[model samples]
Target: MTQRREAAIEKTDLTPLAGAETDVAPLGRQGLKPPHELTADEDVDVTQWNRVAAMDEFKSLVAEKRKFIIPATVFFIVFYFALPVLVGYAPKLMSVKVLGVVNLAYLFALSQFFVAWIIAALYVRAAGRFDEMARNIINRLKSGRE
Candidate 1:
């Protein structure tokens, strides 16, 4: 068995597969260097990052993101868990008919999808502002004004 395995391994091609090159930019390239292509100098500078993190603008950016994220996360968690919780704890209340045969629970469950979409839309809108703030920071860094 060992000899047979060794013979099979010897017969197999050992050459590395060539990846198809494209003109398309690497995934998630918003003016950031591709991970695989970064050199020692291009790699993240801890001191620089620390300096930027200490900046009031960067601090505010972090706070702003946290403000949205924390509440959104909490709300999503509550909204998602509420369905099962309510159904389990308050069956009769959930069973009441709202529109023909559909109960309050069904409506509430269906509404979660819309709520998620609304949250996503809000985040998308908020992200545009966040991106602008980030761009401003990057510009400041590049212009040596930071």
Candidate 2:
């Protein structure tokens, strides 16, 4: 082997440790085994999945999520785009000073960061309720009550 190649390998600590077990696969032109060749234990039941999907509780959960998500998405989109749109169409209004040097445009731009954080916080709070509803649905399914 080249001196440079040996030096590089030593620097990387590629040498196997003493008394350590290794199950390294042989290198081949095709590399590792194809994903399809890998086997996983079957744990999911199709009937259970279908039952969950058909439940009114699940439908309500989806609707509850959409109620918050749809409006939040729309509001964010409008707010994000409004800056550029206002700057282009209403430059005079955007340039109006609010503080000593900071204008409405600067304030609005800075507010976007706070708005995004607020939205994230709101989602986290809402997600807790969504999780509780989902848990109740799962418990009902597990107990075979409905």
Candidate 3:
């Protein structure tokens, strides 16, 4: 029973209703019937794998990417690279007299973490919203309506 069940699951139909007594019948083998290809009835169907559909998808992908790449590159340079350098180098020049007790470098270094947190928050929000907008535009264009 287990062997029959395994065979039924692994191989194509060999049940009694299929009129075949063997489950391991070789298709188009020597001295056997030939393997069949798709008949006439199945060839009349049409779908969107043609050249026009492929070109449309490629163009949509490119347009969606531009909405994200330019602004992100600018933000990465300013917040990640330029800001840190400015902080490290211009400590004395950009000192803040928060109070008589606290100096500018001390305040800046201490609040570096706050600046980092704000930048990260802005990035996450912009990324989520921008991706949604891009996807919506791309989907609209794909359907040939936008």
Candidate 4:
């Protein structure tokens, strides 16, 4: 490695964060702030909520979550990793006669966009079910009888 001539570094002036001149309107700045609104949302009790859940219940919930994650990851990995490698390494694999002009690699490249759309759709479908299941489990765990 070759060494270059060192450049001079300039020091910056450090000052207090708020400064002496500024009139800070902290949490009371309401006009600048967006309007606060509330609806039929459950107000969670922080103290009791922080209490430890049973080990078995936690374990079961984790296991169920893993069930959703693992398969989805496997599916995503196969399509995401394998497809790119297959596209790069074997572009000839996708190439074929179409209109006696165009190659299939061009077509396969376009198929990536379609595959992404399909994956997104499938993930949304799966996530909806997973979210519902998680909500049910959490509701069962919560103390409030709402």
Candidate 5:
């Protein structure tokens, strides 16, 4: 009787349908091969990965990124705030006409948008170099593992 009850409970249980079979899966290895790659293996070189993470080249790449990003951020902050500060403090200068009723303040404010776009474009270009550096590091690690 108890065996029948247990069998019925197992049959009615919905746990298998409620969740994925695997709790966790590996990253970047689920059929996401790049164009240059033919196939990916499940093997992982954890030590090599840790070594690559600690490499000086990797650190320099990060530093190079910060070098551009930090200054750009500071410059943008000051440039963005300068117009409002000038307008609030020196209203006369800000109100002066630059181009037939277009005030200097308005021109400066408008230029901010262009400046931001230029900065973004420049970062995109710079990011290419960063990507190359990271790829080189990864390639080196992969080669060393073999």
Candidate 6:
């Protein structure tokens, strides 16, 4: 390598080595605080969280969300794509005026924006119930009832 290229490569190589030396400790070496030094709740209980997640209530919450979201997504996709299909295949019908300076196709395409917003608002409202269920599950876990 040329002198400049060798110098640049050496600089980059040392950068990561310098960082790793400080970031990662050597094998079998204790970190700043040993494992036993931490309290029970100080560390997150992944197994307890996993058990809570595997509960029937959690499954039902997910199912309820999917019930609304999946259908709403499918409906929106069909509705959104139908506009271009109608415009391409039935220009005459799409040109038919329903309001002043607004053709059927224009109205339909514009309505898609409103439809998306409405669906989002509906989902947000429905999510309140899901949030309640999640809070209940979390409370049960915290209280050691689960």
> Could you give me the TM-score of model 5 versus the true structure?
0.66
Measured against the true structure, the TM-scores of the candidates, in listed sequence, are: 0.68, 0.66, 0.36, 0.47, 0.66, 0.66
What is candidate 3's TM-score against the reference?
0.36
TM-score winner, 2 or 6: 2
Over 4 Å off in model 4, which ranges? Answer: 1-61, 144-146
Cα lDDT tens digits for candidate 4, 1-146: 00111112113434433222223445656554222221112122333345334445555666766786788778767866766787788877756656476666666667768887887787788778767766765766664446
Candidate 1 lDDT tens digits, 9-116 = 665855332322233566777785566665433345546778788888898898999999899999999999999999999999999999999999999999999999
- Better model by TM-score: candidate 3 vs candidate 4: 4
Clashing residue pairs found in predicted model 4: none
Candidate 6 C-alpha error for residue 127, in Å:
0.8
Candidate ranking (lDDT, best to worst): 1, 2, 6, 5, 4, 3
Q: Is candidate 1 or candidate 6 better by TM-score?
A: 1
- For residues 36-144, write the lDDT of model 2, one tens digit per residue: 4332211234457788989999999999999999999999999999999998899999999999889999999999999999999999999999999999998998799
Runs in model 5 lying further than 4 Å from the true structure: 1-49
Error (Å) of candidate 6 at residue 115 is: 1.0
How many backbone clashes does every candidate have?
0, 0, 1, 0, 0, 0
Give the Cα lDDT of each candidate.
Answer: 0.80, 0.80, 0.56, 0.57, 0.77, 0.78
Write the residue-wise lDDT of candidate 3 on 19-76 in tens digits. 2333344555555433343222222222333433456545565565566567656765
**Residue 38 shift from truth in candidate 6, angstroms:** 15
